[model samples]
Target chain A: MKQIVSPGCTTGPFFPVDFSDGSEDLSQRNGLAAKGQHIILTGHVLELGGKPARNMVVEIWQADASGIFRHPLDPRQQDCDPGFWCWGRARTDADGVYRFTTIIPGAYEDRAPHINVAILGIGLTRPLVTNIFFDARADVVFECVPAELRSRLLAKPEGDGVYRFDVILRGENETPFFVE
Target chain B: MMDDSTMKIDYAPYDDATQTLRQIDKYTPSATRVPSAPLIERPLTLSERTGPTELVSKWNVGKLDLCRLAPDSPRALGQLIHVTGRVTDEDGAPVSSVVMEIWQANASGKYIHELDDHRAPLDPNFTGQGRLVTDEDGRYEVFTVKPGAYPVLYSGWWWRPPHIHFSILGTSWMNRFITQIFFPGEVLNEKDLLLNGVPSRDVRDRLIFKPTDTVMGDLSYIGYQRDFVLRGHRQTPELP
Candidate 1:
C-alpha cells in the first residue's frame, strides 16, 4: 500500500468570526430592520497570474429579509439589530484584499430572485458557491434561476450597496461549487 | 479495551479566541425539516447513491440516526464521530472497512436545513452527517458538527471563515472532497474563494489552523486534523 500523491486542497472560511449568529431579534422580521449590509467587499486574491492572495479566509452567508434562516430548521428569525451583524468575516490583509460589514438582504420567494453567496477559500480544498445579483435585476434572475444556476449570475452592480463578485479561482469559467 | 488499532479523539479547550467564539454553534442546512420532531424510527438504508449526485441519499445514517442529547450543554450533547481513516488504493495498501460518509458546517454555518434562510442556532451537538466503516489501517471516524462560520458574497461583498465539509467512499473509491480547516491565525484566509482554489503555496500552507489536542478525560470534541487522498481513477461523480 503506497501510492499517495493526492494531497493539495485548502479554501474554507467564508464565515467564522466565530459564526456570526445574526440577532436583531433574529434579524428583525415583518417589522423590518435588517439593512446594514456593509460593503468594503474589495477584491484581489489573485494567483492564476494576477498575484495577491496573502493569507486567505473570506467567508459570507446571507438570508434575512423574511426568507428566514440563521439556521437550524428555520431559527425562527429576528436577532441581528443593534450594531448589526447580518453576517460578516474577512481575511486578506497582505494585499489579497478582503473586507466585510454585511446587511443588504431582503428578498426571498425562491423562483428566481436570488441572493446566496459562498466563498470559503480560507485554506483551499473547494468552495465558491456563487450567486449575487441586483444590477437592476440581472436579466430577471438569469431567466428564472436553474440553468445550472444561470451562468453563476453577476452583472456588475456597484451602486453603493456595492456589488462586484470576482472569483476566477482557477480558469475558463471557474467558480461554482455548491452542494449545501 | 476497545482496540481495533486504538483510536479516539474528542475536543474542547481554547480559552481565548473570543472564548473559542462562544463555544462554536451554527447549524442550518435544511432542505426542509424532519431532522427531529418526535420522529425516531428508521435507520436501515445500509448503502445507496443514485442520480444527480452531490450524493444526498436522504443525508444517510439510517436506524433513525438518533437525536436526544439536547438538555443544554451536557458537554455539547451527542453529535457522534468515530472516523479512523486509512483506505489505500491506487497504489497504497491497507484498505479495510471503507464505507465512509461525512458532511459539515454545524458549529454554526447553518445547516439543519429545510431550505436555509440563515438565522443560526442549532448545536444540540450537531449531526451534519455520519456513517463510518474504516479500521484496519485505512482508519475512519465520525461524531459530527463543529463547522461554523458562514457568509460569502464576493465580487459584490461579504465574508466567511471557519469551516468543515467532507464526504468519502471506497472499494476503488468514489471520490468527493470539498475540504476546509482554518483557525490558527484566521483573519479569513484572503477572501476564501475555496482558499483561492488552491494553486499551491505549499498546499495553501496545509489549510492553516491547527492547535487542537484534547483527550484527557474526554469532554468530547477533539478534532481539526485533516486527511483525504482519493486519486486512483477520479470517479467523476460530479460535485468535487
Candidate 2:
C-alpha cells in the first residue's frame, strides 16, 4: 500500500554525467574480466510516434554469471564474481541508440536470465522500469506478464553474443513496465 | 525451491494510485518520448526485488556536502541549507541503505554541465551534485545551497521554480523514485508543470519539504525535512 507522496519532475535538458571512466563497460573491472559470455547489448529508445529519444540516461543492473547478486539483500551476496562490475550505464545517442558492454546474467531463483533497466529523459516525466529477458524461459514473472506483452520484454539475439532490445515508451508496442 | 529453506517473491503489480501519469499534457508527451500506448502492467519479481545496492563506490564523486565541491573549496555561492529525510515503507518501517542522490542548479539557476545554455554564472565551487546512502535508520542529511529557478525553453519559456532533483533507489529496483523537492510557498510551485501534473493537490503538497529549526555548532543553516514513503514490506528476510 505504498502511496505516491511526491510527483517527480523532468530533468529539463541536462543533468550531471561523467562516463569517461568506462562505467558503461561492465564486463570487466581493472584488468580482470568477469566470468561469463561477453556480449554487446544495444538498443534504441523511441517515443510513441517513432521519434528517437535523445541523450537520455540508461542504466542496467544484473546478476553475475553465477546467478548471484552483489546486493546486500541477496542471500548469496558473498558468492558474486569479484571481477564483475555488475552495473552498466549508457546514454542514448543522437539516433537514440544506447549500448553497453556486459556479460549475460545467469538465471536466478524463479527468474529467467535478465537485466533490469531504468530510464530517464528530459520529457519522461517519471522514470520507467522494465527488464530485458534473454529468452522465453519458463519463469514465474515472465509467465505472469500478459501473454501478448511478454514479447516486448524478451531481447532479440542477433548472433555472436549481440542482443537487440528496443523500448517504446508509449503507444503501440510500448515496452511493458512495472512498479513494486 | 532451491535448498528448501523458506522464501517467497511476492509479486507487486502496478498500482496506478501512487504512479505518475504516463501522459501528462506538455510535460511528458513529446516527439521523442510520448505516452501513445497505455503502460502494460506486470508483476514484480526477483528482477525487481533485488537491486544494485553496491553503488556509491563507483558513482560517488561528492559525498554528503553540496555546499562545496571539495573539502577545501570555498562555500558555494548561495544560501546554504541542510536537507534531512527518511526513507520508509507504507507500514512506516525504515528502509535503510537506500541509495540516494541529489542534483540541482546553482544559486543562479545554472547547472554545472555543458548542455546548460543559460546565461547564469556557474559557481566554480558548486558542482551541484551529491551522492549518499540512508543511514541504518533510513535517515539521511545533505548540506547544499538553495537552488535557483531556471527557465524551461518549452513553448513560451516558462520559468521553473527552484527545486532539488532527487533520485531514490529503494530496497527494490522498481521503487526507483526520481522526483524533485520544492521549498514550501515558492511562487513557481503553483505553476510548475511537473508539480501540478500530479493529480491530487494533497499529494502535490507532499513534494514540498517543511522548514525545521536546525543548527550545527557555529554554522547555522536553513533546515528542511521531508520523508519519502516507498512500497512493500521492509523487514530484512531471515537468512536461511
Model 1 residue A34 CA deviation (Å) reads 53
Q: Report the C-alpha lDDT of model 1 over B1-240, residue by residue, as the tens digit.
A: 122221111111111211111111121111011011121121111010100121122123332121224334343333333233354544454545444544456665765644345677766645554455556676655444445666643323445676554434333101323344455556766766544444555555555534445444543445445455544422223465
Q: Which lDDT value does model 2 have at B197?
A: 71
Looking only at chain A, give the TM-score of model 2 against the true structure: 0.91
Candidate 2: tens digits of C-alpha lDDT, residues A1-180: 444444555555665765323668888775788999999999999886777887788888898998887766677889999888777778888898999889999987787898888888777767777778988888776776788888999888899998999988766788877642
Q: Judging by DockQ against the true structure, name the best candidate.
A: 2
lDDT at A4 for candidate 1?
38
Over B1-240, each residue of candidate 2 has an lDDT whose tens digit, in order, gives 122221243335434555455556766454447544445556555556666666656665334898775687889989889999898766566767767878899999998777787889998888688678887787989989999998875456678898888887665575667777789999988888777777777777778899998776777789999888765543446679
Q: Largest TM-score belongs to which candidate?
A: 2
Q: Residue B55 of model 1: what lDDT?
A: 16
* Model 2 stretches astray by more than 4 angstroms: A1-12, A19-22, A145-151, A171-173, B1-19, B28-34, B56-63, B214-218, B234-240
Question: In angstroms, how far off is B216's CA in candidate 2?
Answer: 9.0
**Each candidate's TM vs. the true structure?**
0.25, 0.87
